[model samples]
Target: SVVTEMTGLGAHTLRGYERAGLLQPARTAGGMRLYSPRDVAIVRRAAALAAEGINVTGIRRILQLEAEVALIRAEFDGVPQPVVAASAERGASGTG
Candidate 1:
């Protein structure tokens, strides 16, 4: 079930996210945006980051760095992670 506890974002913010190349939530047949559990967390994080005055560009960069750090930590701890494909996609996306 979709979480109903999320803060409602205005259309402008949604549009901004779309422009930022963030993960676009799947739409319902009626065209309403349907955020999954994962997407809900992402939106919450994005909202918190935005409240901290993080611009979209900066957030994108920080997200990329955090993902890289996660992969590195996983490697150091001998945990296998799908880093190659993720890194390649992030690199090609130009958002990081």
Candidate 2:
């Protein structure tokens, strides 16, 4: 697959990542796994983390946390800076 070729990971390793709940590639009607761009990015990141000696469990957690942070940032994207600063100040002062 292009993903395996691009990431330098084997099909077996990709299946292992799916089994480990680290990836959720889409499937075709015939049940072939389809790796989207996001899936490919995740595979690359997971391979890098593994090369850094992080286990699957740690990789999953880090990915989840990074996703959460991205979500939070997206949610804040359109808000005014003053509003964000005020909200932060209120939370800091325990008055939010």
Candidate 3:
């Protein structure tokens, strides 16, 4: 598959990532996995992490934390200052 070629990961490894809930490539009507650019990037990152000796569970946690941080940063970017301030206060007060 293109992703396997691009990421230098074996097809079996890619399938393992999917089974481990790391990758979620879209599927065709015929059920062929379709790798988007983002999916490719994720595969590359996961491969790197695995090379660093991170286990699947560790990789999954790191990815989840990274995604949550990205979401928070995006929300902060678009939110008004007053709302941001209130949210910060709530967080500081342990109410958020």
Candidate 4:
């Protein structure tokens, strides 16, 4: 509900986002979609992008890249030294 309220976008539209891979909200056993705070934030960003005239395809790519960057930042921020070395070795050897 917060998502719908925040975006002024309907449930069907949100579900469309899910179908198009822009959002990945949790789902109930009975298959009802559940929105998290993170999901809401992503949807808000998506809404902003759409309003800026980016189509869903561009929005999806942007969101994907954003997620990847966040993951890379998280990995770098809290990494212990050995894990970094191992990751580097894996990269060089192409064995990972």
Best by lDDT: 2
What range of 10 consecutive residues in model 3 has the weakest lDDT sum?
1-10
lDDT of 2 by residue, 22-51 (tens): 889989999999998988999999999999
The candidate scoring highest on TM-score is 2
- How far does residue 41 in candidate 3 sit from its true spot (Å)? 1.4
Pick the winner on TM-score between candidates 1 and 2. Answer: 2
Q: Tens digits of per-residue lDDT for model 4 on 9-70?
A: 99888988899988788889998788988888888899899999999999999998999999
Regions more than 4 Å wrong, model 4: 79-96
Error of 1 at 82 (Å): 23
Between the candidate structures 1 and 4, which one is better when assessed by lDDT? 4
lDDT tens per residue, model 1, 12-84: 6765776796648888999887877766766667778889999998877776787799898888667335766
Kindly provide the TM-score of model 4 when superposed on the true structure, using C-alpha atoms: 0.70
How does candidate 3 fare on TM-score? 0.79
Order of candidate numbers by TM-score, starting with the best: 2, 3, 4, 1
Clash totals for all models, in order?
Answer: 0, 0, 0, 0
The TM-score values for the models, in the order shown, are 0.60, 0.86, 0.79, 0.70
Q: For candidate 1, report its TM-score.
A: 0.60
